[model samples]
Target: MDLIRQARARLAARLVVVTGASSGIGRAFVEAMAPSGARFVLVARRRELLEQLADHVRDSGSHAMVQALDLRDVEAGRAAAEEVLAHHGIPEVLFSNAGHSIARGLRGLVARPDSVTRSVAANFTGPVCHALPLLGAMCTRGGGHFIATTTVDARTSVPGWSPNVASKAGWDAWARSVAPELRSDGVATSLLAFPLVATPMLPPARRARARCAMSPEAAAEWVARAVVTRQARVAPWWLRPHELLHAAAPVLTARVTAPFSMRLVDRG
Candidate 1:
């Protein structure tokens, strides 16, 4: 079978949980997998959007349960996890894709520190807290997949996007550190280091400049590939080379990129 067929076969009739399912790549992913007959637990802060998406899933002959809550509320997130376990049982696949991005210089952040707090909560603490219970449940079940949507920015520090980059980097590191333990218990983890995708998450200025950004549907295909292959990490071909350059000469790379980074911040 082709990879798409393989992914469909594996996912058919399986219970899948997707965070940030209201729009963008998350919504696109659910739509792509709906035809495969996978049941989904859709999560996002928007109730009406998720309800609309759930209706579409139903139309595609798939089951969808909508959970509308902000992931940043740790208590609420834990409660939602408990509810998912009780109602849907343990999901065979958990796509922890909810994220927040803040593009601010240090000067701006010093004035509005709440942006940093929001970034850390949404990008790192929120997802981790929400997934903790489900992860344990999956471990007991003996077979499950955990997929996280990260960014290429997580691999390197960008001057204008410190909070967003740092938080995502923390998540990436945490997932990598826990992968071995999850594998020992028959649970697999995949971290997708996505490039700029034309999603609502992008700032207006960035979105305008991202003429080459991948569409949400295209990004969803990458997720499906990860589902089928259970790869530990999925990233662009140029990512490693970029990382190497930064690692080899961090100061020089930073100096060379400083002008561009300043421009990005200035635009926002």
Candidate 2:
């Protein structure tokens, strides 16, 4: 227990900036890590929830700040990052977890182009806007961590998740490309590929009985651990083998998973 306490103490000293902190895995992350002593900057669109979360964090004996900004606005993201830098100095950790998804299908994009555009901006471009300013500073400082949540769909497309798959794929490509460039400067970047978590983001119908879906707390624990340990990529144990098979025999893998994947599609 002494070793665990020491580890918690070390992790608690770092400042962590979390996007999407109003709820879900982000809230769980705040709950899991705040007691360990880490100060947090919580960013989200909902001001009320952010404040409530801030109160919770302060109650836990950790400092908490709230930033209410829509990430789809690139300039806003940059501005928020600057404010954080000015007020709190360079953050040791950035949990770039803000994202959006169109769960129905590509039809939603055709029916609602603006929503689709915002979703793409939120998942890919928005985080990059926030990250660019901080990454440069982290490079100069020679120490910092940038962690973002991704999904297995980034690599393989699912039946009703075209927008989500595309957005994640774009982010995965961009982040992976930039990872090596940051390595020389000692800025660690990680893309955590989560399969499915039982969060509000998942529809009630889907979340009702998804045995394989991880709890938000479980996902948050992995994310917090990754931030503390500076892990480059966090993925389930089974994901690698599936990725390998998909790479080795794309057609065969797709054929095998088609029925199963299609079953989860919401045809509305």
In TM-score terms, which candidate is top?
1
Instruction: Give each model's whole-structure lDDT.
Output: 0.89, 0.81
TM-score of each: 0.96, 0.91
lDDT of 2 by residue, 108-156 (tens): 4577666556668989999889888888888889988888888877887
Minimum summed lDDT over a 10-residue window in model 1 is located at 259-268
Deviation in Å, model 1, residue 124 alpha carbon: 0.2
- Tens digits of per-residue lDDT for model 1, 85-204: 998899999999999877788888888788878889999999999999999999998989999999987878688788888999999999998899899999999999999999998777
Candidate that scores best on lDDT: 1
